[model samples]
Target: MSDDQAPSTENGGGGDVETVEKSEDHKKLVDFGLDTTVADELEKLFQAKLVTYDDLDPRALEAIRDFPIECAIAVLKQLLADSNLQHVNNKSAYICGVMKTYRQKQSLGEDKPAVTNGPDEKKLKEILDRTGYALEITTGQRKYGGPPPSWDGGPPGNGHECFVGRIPKTVYEDDLIPVFEKFGTIWDLRLMMNPMQGCNRGYAFVTFTTAEAAREAAKQLNNYEIKPNKKLQVNVSIANVRLFVGNIPKNKSREDILEEFKKLTEGLREVIVYAFPDDPKKKNRGFAFLEYDTHKSASGAKRKLASGRIRVWGSEIIVDWADPQDEPDEETMAKVKVLYVRNLRSNVTEEELKKIFEPFGEIERVKKVKDYGFVHYKERDSTLSALEAMNGYKLHEVEINVTLAKPANENKARERRMRRERDNNMNMGYDDYYSSYPPASFGPPPPMMRGRIARGGMRGRGGMMRPPAPMDYYDDYSGYGQGYGYDDYSSYGGCYEDFSAEYSPHPVTPQPPHRGRGRGGHHAPAPVAWTSNAAAAWPPWYAQRSGGYGTAWRGQSWHQ
Candidate 1:
C-alpha cells in the first residue's frame, strides 16, 4: 500500500499509545529480569475493583517497573556511604530488598519524585542557590543556617534571637540573608522548610552576634514585606536545638534509630521515640525527637536531609526543628487556668487549697476533694506561677504536687461522667417512684430497706454504681467525682475524680419522671404504694433484698 494509504500509527490514539507503552513496559520488565507477579496481582486487583487505582497514574500501572540502572546504582552507593550494608549479602539480595522497600512505599500511595530525572547534586546546589527549591521533593522538612565569621565561640546571648514569621514560603535564605544582614552580622539565620512542598514554613529564627543587633533587626524588619501583601513578624524568641524526625519506620527501635542517625550525622546525642502506653509491640509513633550536641550540627543535618538527596533505611525521612511539648501549649494554657493539685494533707480544706494557690494568681474557683483538688485561675500567667511554685511546695507538712489541669483528660472525663450520670439517672426506678408519689402520707420506706436506702441520688439501692471496666478505659489520674454538695464532696473526697477511688461517683440530675410513672412531679409527697398499680402493699422480705428491674422495680408495672 502507498505510504499515504497505510494505516497511520496514530489512527487510534488510545490504542497506539497503549500499545507503545505496553511494549516499553514489556522491555523494561524483560531487562530487569525480575518477577512480574506483583504487577500482575495489582492489575488483577484493579480489574476486580478490589483495590483503588488511577488509570492515568504511571505508578499504578507500573508499580513494579524497574528504575533507571544509573539511578539505582547511585542510590545504592549513597546508602552504603551512610550505613554498613553487611545485612545484605549479594547483588540479588540487595536488588530484592530495594524493590521490596520501593513496592511498600508505592503501596502506601506515596507520590515518588523523579530522583533520576531530576538535577544532579551540583545542579541541585546551583538551583537551590538560585531558586531556593529542590527538584526531588519528599515528605518532612529541612533547616538551613550557619554561624557568621565572628570571633566569639559562646552561644547567642540573652535576647539575641528574633523570630521572623509571616514570610512567604516561596522566599528562602538566598533572598532573606541579604535583607536581614543589613541590620548586623547574623550569628545564625535558620529558615524552616517543608520539603514535601519545597517551601518555607512561613517562620524562621534569626540570631545576631549581639543582643543589640537582634533588637535592631526586630525593630527594622518587624512587618517588613518580603512578598506582595505579606509582612514578617519579627520578635524576640527563644532558640532550640532539637529536631523532629518524621516518617521513621515504625518497626525501628530507639537503638536502631539512634545508631543510624549517629552514622548519618555528627553530634547526634539522643533519639527520643515515644510509644503508646498501651502498645503491645511498643513501635515508635513513626517519628522521633533528636537532640544534637550543638545547634550547628542539627542545622547541618537538616540541610543535608532536606536536599532530597538521601533516604534513611531505604525510606524517605522528614526532619524539622522540634516544637517543645513538655508542657501545655499556649493556646491550651490560655483556655484552661485550672491547676491539678495533688499530694495534699488529709486535713487540707477547700479554703486551704484556695489560700495556697491564690498567692500566685487571682482565684477563679476552688474545690477541695480529699487529698487533692483543682484551683482555677483567672489568668494563664498566674496559673504558670502557681504551677511552678506549688509543684513541690510544702503545705500542711506535705509536699504539694501541682500541674496544669490537662483539660483534655478532664474534658473527656467530664463528658463520660455526664453520660454515665445520665444513664444512671435514666435507670433509677425507685427515685421516680418516690418523686411522683401523691400528697397522701406514706410511712417511711419499708423497715428493712431503711438504712440500706442508697443515699446521694440513690433511693432503693438502684443508684449503686460501678467503676469503669479496667479493660475498657485505662487512666493514670483520678476519676471525675460527680456529687457537688460540700457534704457529699467531703464524704466522697473526690472519689469519682480519681479512677482508683472506691466509691462510684455519678451525680444524679433531677430528670423528668419516667413515662411509666404516669403522674409525677419534682417534689411530691412519698406514698406507700402506687395509686395506679402497686406491686405489693409490702413485698416479701426476700423481694426487698434482691429486687429486679422492668417488673415494678425499674418504674414499670409488675403486670406489664
Candidate 2:
C-alpha cells in the first residue's frame, strides 16, 4: 500500500511485524522520536484526526479567559496537527496553543474556515460539542474596577471596556508593548490625543485575539512597570474609534493577520481585531477593520499602496478601510409649554418625581415645588405621564387637583386688587357704624306749685290755715326720714323744700351683725338734714372734724 494508506506503527499497533510479541513486551508500541520528528508525526496524525484534553497549562489557559471554549479547542487542534507531536501531551499542547491563539486573535482577529469541516471548523465544532468549559470577560482601569461586556461566542473586542485615563503614544508603543507582550499579543493600541491639549488624557484602547490573552495582558501588565515610568496602566478599553471591524474568521485564528501586517509597518504598536456575530459556527467571511493609535497611522495606511489586493492566510482577503468622519452637530433643547402644579404632598421630592416619568423619555430637568407644589418635569412627556399616573391620586389623605399654573404677572395683579378692596370695605364699615349712633339727651321739668296754692277759685281750710297732720303720716314722715327729729317742710309751707328743712332721706343698705359683740343693742341710724346753703356754710375744719362733734358745731353755729 502507499505511504498514505499504510498503517504506521503509531496507531496502538505494530503492523506487519515478523513475530508477534506479548502485550508486556511491546508496552510502548509507538517509539517517540526527537522533538522535531515527534512534532511532524503529530502534525500528520492531526491532519487525520484531532485530540482533546481537560487539563491545560495554567498561564496559557488563563490567557484566553474571556475566549470561547471552541476557540481554545481550535487552538489546541492547530498545535496537535502533527503526528509526532501527539506525545507532547494533550494538556501541555492545549495550554500553549490557547496562549498563542489568544495573542494572535487579539492583533489579527478571528479566522474563518475556507472549507466545510476544515481544520479550523473541525476544531471549533469539537470544542462547541465538548462539555465543561466556561468563559469570563472584564475591562476598564486597574485603579477603578472595569466593566467587561459579556458575550456568547468568542470574546468580543476590548473596545467596550471603561477607560478613565490616557498615556503618551511613544510610551504606549515602545515602553508599554514590551511589558504587555509577555502576557499576549496586543492587537491594537489607541491613545486619544485631544486637539486642544496635546498631552495624553490618561487612557488607551487595547485589543487581544483571545479573551484569555486579553485577560492575561490585563492582569500582568495592567499595573506593570515600564522604564523611565513607574508602571504601564493597561486594561481592556472601550471602543473610542469611529470605525470598527466585522466578519472575523470562525477558527478563532489571529496569527495569519499579524504576519500579514508585519510587512506593512516596522513596529505597529497594536491593532484591535474582533469578531462580529454571523452565526453560532463562527464562520467569519474574512474581513475586519484595523484601528490605529492616531489619525496619522490611519492616514498613513490610507496613503500606502494596496498592491491592488489584500492577502490573508495565504488567501486573497478583503479589506474595509475607515476614514475619520466629522461628528454630527448637536441639536438645541426645545422650549415647551409647562403647567405649574401646587398642593402636592409634603414628602414629594424632585428626584422621586423624576423617577416616576423617566420611562417615557429623557427628562431635561425637574423642579419640585418648594411650597408643597407638585413637581414639574422639564419635558412634556413626563408631565403627561404624571397627569395620567397621579391625577386624583390620594396623598396624605388628601386628593390632589391638577391645573395650569397662572402667569406670575396675572397672579400679582389679582392679589393687589383683592387687598385694596378689603382695605376700603374695612374703612367704610367703620365710618358708617359711627354715623348710625347718636349722643344721649336729657331736660329739666317745669317748676312746681307751692304747697298751699288753690287749684280752683278758693283754697281748702287746711291749706288756708296750717296743714293738719298728713293722712299717710308714716309714709310722709318716712319719705322725709321719720326715725330722726325731722320737721315736715311741706307742712311748714314752701314751694320748694324750706331753707330750714328738717331732714334728707337716704337709702339704707342692709348690714351684717357683728358676731363678736356680746348682746349688743343695734343703734337706729339718725336722719341726715340738709339746710339751705349748708354745704357752702361748712366750717374750714370740715375736712378734719367729721363725727357727732361736727354736727353739734353746725347746730351751735346756726344758733349763733
Candidate 3:
C-alpha cells in the first residue's frame, strides 16, 4: 500500500515507522478513567487566550503528603467528573485541598467520619479548655477553637458582622480574637483557608452581638496593623438571607419546585415561582426564589450552586441575589411589641430567653420552638425597647437574631414594595421574595373568564400576558399565589416578543368602560395608549425605561 496507509511502529525493526504522539491530556484520560472530558473542554474554551492546567495535579499532592498515588488519582477523577471550569474557579488549587482531606482521613482509618484535624487541630484545641470549632479538610475550611459555649443576649441583627481583609496567611483567631473582643461578644470568626498551602486565603468575617459592635470594629480596625506591615481593611457587611434562582423549568409546581431544590442543597427555607396568569394550566414564568434560614447557610448554598456542582433537570441554573428590598420600614418595625428571636443556643430554655429580654420590656409571654423563640411585650414601646437592646444579644454564648415578629406571608419584600408605592416614589413591582404565597388577605385564585373582565380589570404596558380574571364568573382559579393582581411579567403568543429574565412588571392602569356590554352595564375599556413619559415614573432601581413591546432598553428586549 502507499505510504498514506502507513502503520505506527517507531520501536520496531521495519514493521512500522511511525508512532502515535501522546500528549499529557491523552495520558490523563486513559489513567483517570473519568466519564467526563470537562477539563479538556475548558482548555479548549480558554485556548491560547488563557493558560489552564487540564492535567491532574495529583502527583504534586502525592509527592508532598506521602499519600498513595492511587487515592490521589481517585479524588482527581471524582472532581473532574462534574468539573466545569466556570464552576471551579481554580481547579488545580481545589484538587490540592481534596487530596489533603483524603490523606488525613485515610491515615486516621476513618474512611468517613467527623473532622479529625490531627496535629494542627490538636494544637488549636489544646489552647482552650473546650474547642468550639469543627474542621472539614476536604473544603480546606476549618474552625479552630469555636465560639464560647453561650452569650448573654439574642443574635446580632443586620450589620452585626463585618468583613476583614488584607490578612497575613499565617494569622489565626488566637492572635486576633482577644484584640477584637473589646468591642463585644464575638459571635463568629471565619478565616478562609487554602488547604494546599496550609495557610489562609487572606480574609475573614468577625460577627459580634450588635451592629454597634460591628460598626465599631469596622471603624477602629480599618487599616489597623495586624502583622508587622499588613494592615487590615474592614467593612460592615449586610446580611443576605435570600438568593435569586433563574432558568428553572417553567412546568414545575410549588411542591415539585421545592423537591428539586431540596435535593441539590440545604437551607432552602422557601421557594417562590412566578406563574403565567393567562395559562389555565398554571405553569410558572420560569424563575423562582430561594430563602435560607441564615446568611451562612445562604452563602454556602450559593457557593454550591454557583460552583456548578449542582444542576436542575440536568441543566445548569442561574444563582444570584434577588433585587434587595430596602430594610423593613423602621416605622413599621417600631409599631410592634412582639419580637421574633432566632439562633438561640439549641438547649436554652424559654424561661431563660424571656428573662434575658425582660429587663428591657415587660414580657407578655414567651413561645419557644426549637432554636427560635418569640417574646411578646406588654406595650409597643417595650417591644421597640427590647428589639433594640436584645437584637444581636448573646445568650448562653449563642448570638441570637431578634427583630419585630411578622406573621407568615408578611415578608420584608412586600413591606418595602408597599412603602415605595405609598411614597409615590417610582414605578414599583411586587417583590414577594420572602413568601412563596401572597398575603393571607390576597385570598384564593379568582374564577377564569373570557370576553369578560373582573370589576378590577387592570391594564398594563402593552403585550404583558396577565392571568385573566372572569368575564364576571366563567372560569375558577386553580393555583396558589396566582390570584394576586399584576405580580409578574409573563408574555404569551401575540403579546410581547422580547421578554428577558431581567424584565420586571410595570404599572397597571384600570380599564375604563368605553362601551356598554351584556348584563350589569359593564363596558369594555379601550386599550391603554403607551406613552413616552410612562417609563420616567419607573422606580429608580430600574436602570432602563419601558418603551413598550419590541422596544429595546440597554440592548435588551423590554416586554418580549
TM for every model, in the order presented, reads 0.29, 0.17, 0.35
lDDT tens string, model 3, 134-184?
Answer: 322325543432344555544455556777778787777666676677787
Cα lDDT over the full model 2 = 0.32
lDDT of 3 at 117: 23
Cα shift from native, residue 294, model 3 (Å): 4.5
TM-score of 2: 0.17
**Ranking by lDDT, best first?**
1, 3, 2
Model 3 bad stretches (over 4 Å) = 1-127, 130-142, 145-160, 194-199, 209-212, 227-230, 239-241, 247-260, 273-285, 294-560
Expressed as tens digits, the lDDT of each residue in 7-72 for candidate 2 is 334322456532122121112112221132232333343344443222334453345444454554
Order candidates by TM-score, high to low: 3, 1, 2
Which portions of model 1 show Cα errors greater than 4 Å?
1-170, 178-187, 192-223, 230-342, 345-347, 354-393, 401-560
RMSD per model, one decimal? 22.2, 51.5, 20.1
Worst 10 residues of 3 by lDDT: 527-536
Model 1 agreement with the true structure over 1-560: per-residue lDDT tens digits:
54322322222225643111122333344444523333333333333433333321444223234654433433333333332222222334333444445445456775342122111345436534653422222222223334443345655633567778787766765567668778876766666554333356677777777767877788798889887898887866534446766668778888998999888888777776544323426456566767675557777988887667889988777565542211223454456567766555567788878876778879977766434577868888898788778777877555555666544334435544444445446655535544543333212222233332222132221222322212122232233221111111111111123343333444333433321111111211111110111011111122221111111221111110
